[model samples]
Target: MPHHLIRKLEHFTKLSCDDRQVLGAVASKRRTFAEHSDIIEEGNDPSHVNLILEGWACRYKQLDDGRRQIISFFVPGDLCDTHIYILREMDHSIAALTPVKVAEISRASLDRLMDEHSRVTKALWWDSLVGVAIQREWTVNLGQRTAIERLGHLFCELFLRLRGVGLTEGDSCALPLTQMELADALGLSNVHINRTLQELRRAGLIVLKGGCLTIPDLAALQKASLFNPNYLHLDREGRNLDANEPASD
Candidate 1:
């Protein structure tokens, strides 16, 4: 049913049965990628939009020195590249963090869906805007926050995002990244990442084990990290519009 995509879209605005049906069609074609494999390379001309259905992927860029920086994480229901057809070539690469399943929607299919489904189009726009906001938040996390704060903020954000998609159980969610991967994402050394993780555990703020992350006290973690949810734009938008009608009205 592509409920993950529906749940995510409805977070922005309600979706009708038809909206849900079309979204299901959007996810009809599925592709799988092995863990640590690049879903799309940095310089390749993107042909289709990839929507995550299961597992995780990350957008990252590699420097000439071989250092990699993870720009963003894509969970289920997240689009890897929605309007990337406009670009001549990809600016960054996306890699699977686990055995990942994705829906590959071609440009023609996407355009037809948007042309026919106004609500879906608007929801997509909301999703795109939130992506930009998240990038900005990551920038602040890297440039301004301390190591502990950076890690804490990331956890809080991931927990809420997973919970929103009904992928989280209680205060916990699947976090399959290795310590080295976390180091790459957070711009820290492996040793530094390990130390910061220990500190978080000692503080009784988080419990990360067995490829899963659990927050015992979300509010306390948010405080320590100076985390804010406003950037996610998770609040339901366009409430005045009818779910079954076109969003343009």
Candidate 2:
């Protein structure tokens, strides 16, 4: 692993000195990705399990006639394949939501690391559980919420997720997505998306101008969308420190 990459993972993974030394002994490569690049494709061979060192991405499945259902967006520090470990081929595809950079850790190396250190493996597994929670939230939104509310819920989720990685501002974030991307993720028509967005704007909830989003009434939007961030398990990493009280550098 590169010295800087090893250092960063150690900060996040809550690794012991011994384990960090072991991982640092191995070579880890960084890979850059362009926006809209397909990092993992449905029905393609699964050769590696990737970790996101930077950028945003979405895991999605497309229906016939080109309709798509976005599973979840991957961000920095997220594992790209926590749920696809035993795959003969990828059952779902992952695409960059923005220009991305990742660390490509081969399966063999990951296996050895897991066998040697369960905490590292468990940390990756925790990521997939969060992904599942995001999917559940989506399922609930699709099944229960109105289109406007669904969009609000998704926006809240994305905003919080981005903020977790320190990629968001106080009440807004850079939105690189088009209306089409929003429609696919929320299962609404692009035209409907525009109308709903306009409604939110008129109601003093949010504003999207020039692809930038500003949420003026976050509390109202969260209430309207019925969004709750408890399922994300974002505090899990901190718990390890509380339990162990190990000196961190």
Candidate 3:
């Protein structure tokens, strides 16, 4: 299996060989979940943090009437919620969108790893910072972007995230989300979501078929979506960690 966490961390800082081995060892004891199954339910006490190894999942909350709002999507190399053990119970639920594999790291083990590895600890902190940045971007996306721009921004974000974990090929990637799932994430009705996708397709911006998305012109799509990748914090070095304008490709 790919050392996705290591690869993700290396983007911020290089890890020594020993650090890589330690991360791999700590991420053992993998398990799988079926599609639509809750990995961690709301109000449940979480004793372990999960690292995604395969497939996709989402953090979501349900309304009294059973309407769901997806808070965020989790792809390979994502930490479901680090340090969640500090809380008495989960505030939201994490459910698998596809057949998913995850490695559960116990609180004790995580604490030990942090204590023993300064560089690894710093890398994890950087990872947490990026998570916060993404949440802020999502808030902006919901509050400001139009339906078409909202969906387009989402596609760009996913493409980059998947590319970070080596899940993308060239300009295309597997986008296994259904229209209903997209609607929930974007806070739009299914009809609106479908219409927005059609608009993007008709504009010669994207090719989404068979659960895959291909952006023919990434720069054009970025402009159409009004997307700025500054929130992603993907700089090779830790300098300029704060959000800024998107970097030139």
Candidate 4:
């Protein structure tokens, strides 16, 4: 094992080398999922918790009537099953939105980490709470924001999250999202998404070309989304953006 997973954890919390190795002991590379692959079937017992090492995925719930609603999307360094432990059976299905690399951390591994270091366990649990808060924020956005605001908030989220993983630079990044995907995330029609994107461009906030985001004004963009870091629970041993971003260069 490359033990690269520990690198992500090293920044978020204060783990001793031994503790780091212990956690790494349980982490192993998972099978890669192709774009649109069904990762976990709804109503199935989740067998293991997975940490995203690469790419994007979405969790969604479907109704008997055939309507589907996306609940959350996982980015790099986000736990694919951080909340799945409490799930006796998955209520929703997860799908890879792009080629995705995951790391499987078995339940036994999680139990061992929790037993060895309570702080590590607490930090991981806090991640789940933050996940809930994000879903709540999305609900508020969908209920109140205009299509433009909704889209802006989604963009803000992408920038911040990618920043968290040290993947952003000078207000620009490779953002491979289609208009239809944006529409699904924002609960709007594709036409509405296209119109809002144009409005964002007109405002000198953002531009999309060649599947890349050119954010001319990151500060203004964050303001538009009411983006807040408090919900992210920055106390983890690793994945600390502030502690990592400035040093990334």
Off by over 4 Å in 1: 238-249
Q: Write the per-residue lDDT of candidate 3 for residues 30-135, one digit (tens) a residue.
A: 9999999999999999999999999999999999999999999999999987889999999999999999999999998899989998888888998999999999
Q: For every model shown, what is its TM-score relative to the native structure?
A: 0.95, 0.83, 0.94, 0.86
lDDT by candidate, in order shown: 0.90, 0.74, 0.89, 0.73
Separately for all candidates shown, the number of backbone clashes (residues 3 or more apart, or on different chains) is 0, 3, 0, 8
List the lowest-lDDT window of 10 residues for candidate 4.
Answer: 240-249
Task: Give lDDT for model 4.
Answer: 0.73
Tens digits of per-residue lDDT for model 1 on 1-249?
Answer: 777878888888878777888888877889999999999999999989999999999999999999999999999989986899878999999999999999998889899999999889998999899899998999999999999999999999999989989999988899998888889999999999999999999999999999999999899999999998989887776444565665342
Error of 2 at 6 (Å): 10
What ranking emerges by lDDT with the best candidate at the front?
1, 3, 2, 4
Best by TM-score: 1
- Selected candidate, larger TM-score, 2 vs 3: 3
Clashing pairs in 2: 1-26, 1-27, 1-28
Clashing pairs in 1: none
Candidates, ranked, TM-score: 1, 3, 4, 2
